[model samples]
Target chain A: MTELEFDYLRAYLKQRSGLALTPEKRYLVESRLTPVCRRFGLATLRDLVGTLKVARDSAIEKAVVEAMTTNETFFFRDRTPFDLFRDVLLPQAMARRAGQRRLRIWCAAASTGQEPYSLAILLQEAGVKLAGWQVEIVATDLSTEVIEKGKLGLYSHFEVQRGLPVQWLLKYFTQIGEQWQIAPSLRSMVDYRPLNLLNGFEALGTFDVIYCRNVLIYFDTPTKADILGRLADRLGPEGALLLGAAETVIGLTDRLSPNPQHRGLYGVAAPVVRAASPVAPPVSQLRVAAR
Target chain B: MTNDPAETRTCLVVDDSAVIRKVARRIIETLGFAVTEAEDGSDALLRCAEAMPDVILLDWNMPNVDGYAFLQALRQRPGGTGPKILFCTTENDVGAIARALRAGADEYIMKPFDRDILTAKLEQVGVVQADAA
Candidate 1:
């Protein structure tokens, strides 16, 4: 890919998906788009870009973004988050919501449903602890392919072994052949849908707990902070936000602050600033504000 | 028959071929779950009656009670919860996958699967939440 072509592709990804690809990502762009080129029978990246120029929602457009968006994930991925979730966050959230008796969670970048299903199993393990509370988990990903897979709640034998314990394996999953599937009740606990975090997902309603992990690393600083700001607006007063272990609320936005008791967890600070710019108001636009 | 959480969970591997059983057995045991082998569907059913494994890696086209037949019968067993059944097939036919789903199979696997494929399918079926605990 020429410098000129790389520049255009970078701009296209930003405009179309709010992803900011740095100059170092030149090889990444080439490798990701190479397959798309072969599939469309285009000889060069330039030709692929040319085809994308004409139509919105073109097949090429979808394929390009799907290729760029990383879908790597597994059940309970990092141990800390799930541990905090079941042992500390969940029980506390349950207690805090006892008066209302309802809970809603959103898993941004849900990939193929491992994260959400993991949450379901925890809730299931809690059993009677959640006796009367109504619960809903919304798992969203930019890739329709993974979203569809998430809906099926199927994983290869490999997926089940990673981070998932044998006990949960027995309790929550049933073997089909060489693959395993989430139990019907657990699968139904989550609603997986096509969502791009850049589009802003507040329309799904405020959530008590939002797990948006390992997704912020893809964007530039402005996009990262902007997404964090929008996420702040979506948290219920009693809610907490769980980010990837490597992620932080520090310096991103004044609306969310690091929780004293948790390393990677953030909570809404009082007097939510709601992004200093016109997020598009009542709340200003969720899109990044002009500098 | 065991309810002890610390007791290694059981995986009943049913395949007529001794070689496939050995290969699957090594992988499943390495996964830390106890492995039981059955040469065909009849043996598999008898083993299952004695104990409902956490996960069952079933093979289609077995003698006497085939994978589909075992699946249909297994689902009908009166119980608290039946074992999660994953039907293994040598064919990559879409029709076969659809049939497995219809037969109340929890998931499916193809022949010559390695540790990764088996692990992923097991996680998908929830017989193992390696990430959760």
Candidate 2:
């Protein structure tokens, strides 16, 4: 690809999905989009771009975005975030929502459903502890194909082998053909939807817990800040936002700050009123890490 | 399978190689399981007879009774249904994995796995940390 072509492609990706690709990532673009070009029966990279440019094609655009997005994920990935979820987050959220007895969780960019399903299993295990509490999980991803897969809840042996322990499998999955299908009860807990981070999130409503991990790294700094700002707007006063360990809110946005007691966990900017959520460590006692 | 919470679950590691046993022992111990070593199938059967293990990491190829034969014999013993058997070997073929599963193995792991893979396998077969839930 020529410099002008590369620039066009980079600008196109940024405009379409808020993905930031530099000149150095030209090789990555070529590798990821080559198969898309072939699949669409286009002769070359420039031909694909020309085809995209001539008309407003939603189908081709969807295919292109899906091809570019990294859908790599697994159940209970990285472990610590889950540890915090089970131990700290859930209990705190439970306390805050105790009177109302209603709690909602959103797993944004929930690739292929593993992260959300993992949360369902954890919540299910604590069924006795959470009795009479209205609980719901909303899992969303940018790719429609992945959303369909997430809805199916079917996993290969290799997928099951990744992070899922046998106890949960035996309790929750029944072997159908070669794959293990997640139990119907667990599947019913989540509502999977196709979501684009660049679009409006008005329908998502407020969430008590939002997992926007790992996805922010793909966007440019401004987009990241914008997304974080919108996410903060959607958080309930006592709600918690969990980010990828590699991600932080320091320079990106002033709307969020890390929770002192919890690492890689954030709270909405402004003075947190310690009126409802018992799980939140007192705001006055928050130990802010120096940027 | 032991319902007693106080009982530390035991894991019998059966392999001919010392290095493999040491590696398996360290990983199993990290999961809070009591580790027992047996050089081969015969020794493993003997150790299992004295006190049943909750989980077994059996090698496919070993002297003094191969894995399949020992598994067949062990399944006939009382309380044999309790322990979850995992065949850990260099067998990467589907036929070997199917064979092990048919011979009463609960899980199968190919050689050259890491700590995460080992833990996940153990967890998949229900060797979960009590507090992790």
Best model per TM-score = 2
True contacts kept of 2: 0.29
List the candidate 2 regions with Cα displacement exceeding 4 Å: A272-291, B1-57, B60-133
Residue ranges of candidate 1 with Cα displaced over 4 Å:
A55-57, A272-291, B1-133
A52-113: candidate 2 lDDT, tens digit per residue: 88978888778877888889887888676887999989999998888999889999989899
Q: Per-residue lDDT for B64 in model 1?
A: 85
The C-alpha RMSD in Å for every predicted model, in order, reads 12.1, 9.7
Q: Of the true interface contacts, what fraction does each candidate have?
A: 0.07, 0.29
Question: Per-residue CA lDDT of candidate 1, range B3-64, in tens?
Answer: 34587789999888899999999988877788898888889878888888888999898778
- In terms of DockQ, the best-performing candidate is 2
iRMSD, per candidate, in listed order: 8.2, 5.6
TM-score of each: 0.66, 0.74
TM-score of candidate 2 relative to the true fold: 0.74
Model 2 CA lDDT for position B27: 85
Residue-by-residue lDDT tens digits, candidate 1, A116-231: 99899889988998998899999999999899999998887567666575457666777777678889999888988898888867689999899999999888888899999999
